[model samples]
Target: MAKITGETRLENVLVYMANMGRELIVADRCTVWLIDEAKQEVYTTVAHGVREIRIPAGTGLVGHAIASGEPIIIEDAYLDPRHNPDNDRKTGYVSKSIITIPFRNNDGTVIGAYQAINKMTETAKFTSKDMELLSLAASYAGKSLESVMLHQEIVDTQREIIATMGEIGEMRSKETGNHVKRVAEYSYVLALALGLSPKEAELLRTVSPMHDIGKVGIPDAVLNKPGKLTDEEYEIIKSHTRIGRQLLKGSRRELLRAASIVAEQHHEKWDGGGYPNGLKGEEIHVYGRITAVADVFDALSAERVYKAAWPLERIERLFREERGKHFDPAVVDAFFAKLPQLLDIRERLTDKG
Candidate 1:
């Protein structure tokens, strides 16, 4: 039940299955290999004493099991020419008794294989009971792996859509090319420097691209204006924040929720002077506060239709000056802390004409 329930991450699932198979069959080592059909390769990350190994599909004993869709037990692996001894040669571990069991998805299509090396029992060879236990474990693992892989696919697709939507908004405002990309990278570094977990920082990077997604609704005249705007026109410009939040706030998805907070509050100032909600200090969501610094730094440092890119020194000075009054102090400190990384991101993703 634990193998098939409550685990969603592919890496975690692989570890669980590998550990269970090794303990149940009393083997020295166990490896769970997943077939990457697109690359025609099989890879394993949960192999004992191994970093990560990838080999051509059907290249070794494990691959043969996956390719032939059958289980095989070897009393002496060295006697079998089908066994790949390269890993053993590299790691100085000799293989003797082994069992390989192929696993399948709901459609009965072979998707992966489990290989356990060197039975730990006194016989030093796998018996019928060991084979049956491994086969049953493989069967139970198949559906759970498929479900987790499908969930990952959906998540990747959603993130792509969100990123493309961000690019579309940038295109609409004539701020075309790499601006959102720079901001996303910048936001990620800032999030990490501020002590967010790697997962949380990665989530911020994925959603930060959509920070300006509301700009899609602003009129062309206001969005593309190349001169100082009239007060009324400036107010119209500020409405993009609200427009962006409105577009994403309806979604209950976690990514969208974070994007909505960023869209709505990225313009808010630290001292209760910013527009829309005028949220002050920590009152604003950390995502929004982090993005505000990222978005502004990119906007100021990147060339725009209305203005040439400001020099790096000037931009840095402004950030220093605005540390507490216009921006979160901790976020600003993070920007300086990760300045080298942020500069590298800006250079790599620099806009091209």
Candidate 2:
């Protein structure tokens, strides 16, 4: 007996059934057709022996079996009015008998129809035992396809959530652009250049966008102010680091934890002159260091309410000048080396607004 196992491919299942226990199994051709509810049509997926055939629901024995969700056994193809002989003519193989069974999902919904044609040797017809075996095989195929679809749905939902959170952070900054995407891409490139593993690079790509999430705590007036910030206003703005840390503290998720570190230390300078705790050098989290370079690069090149956009030349100059003073020297070096590719990404992803 042929067994249907978890994670088995549909083609393998079909081949297994063709070879299992039946003496003249090699003489038959197998075909699978999936029903399209919206189109009211049946499409062929796999066809052997039979060239190809498609019929509407209730048009032929195959269609009738699918519509009625039952097994069909045709012993004399030429005598059956519902038999479509075009397929046999196309494949140059006469059909003596065919057994088709409706494949049902776990919810009892008919997912497709499976058919085995032209039983070999004696005039033996398809039996109840054959239908029962094929039905079991179809069930396993349905479950495997369902599992794959469910997994895709989960991945799509995660992507939507991440995109929504990034939008929220971008809206809080009063920066009318794709600042989040640009910074995230920049951080990813920088992480790769710094020799981090691929997984770490991807983590930084996603978490870097949340570095300014604490800006949500700042007042709208200060956050969207058009003029230069005063010392007092600047001090309040600087507190966003701690505010971000506080907001994200105690989370067990590694992404959120990394976001918290980035929020707190992205503004900290290489020389220890930057805000909140004034921690410097290797004291800063690597995520924070990478985000700092990315954030500053984007901010400099992007036009904001308070600052005009800097030319690429000037941006490169500032990075080189501030290597050890404002930015990590290693990160800065990597940024310059990969500047061309970064510029291409920035241009490709630039927001029209």
Question: Candidate 2, which segments miss by more than 4 Å at Cα?
Answer: 1-159
Best by lDDT: 1
Per-residue C-alpha lDDT of model 2 across residues 145-264, encoded as one tens digit per residue: 555445545645654555566668669877643888889899999999999998799888877877887788899898888998999899889988898889787877666788789889
Judged by lDDT against the true structure, how good is candidate 1? 0.90
How high is each candidate's TM-score?
Answer: 0.91, 0.62
> Alpha carbon lDDT of residue 101, candidate 1?
94
- lDDT scores in order: 0.90, 0.77
Quick one: best TM-score, which candidate?
Answer: 1
Q: Candidate 2 — which pairs collide?
A: none
The total of clashing pairs for model 2 equals 0
Model 1 misplaced stretches (Cα beyond 4 Å): 1-4, 86-93
Clash statistics: count for each candidate: 0, 0
Weakest lDDT window of 10 consecutive positions for candidate 1? 1-10
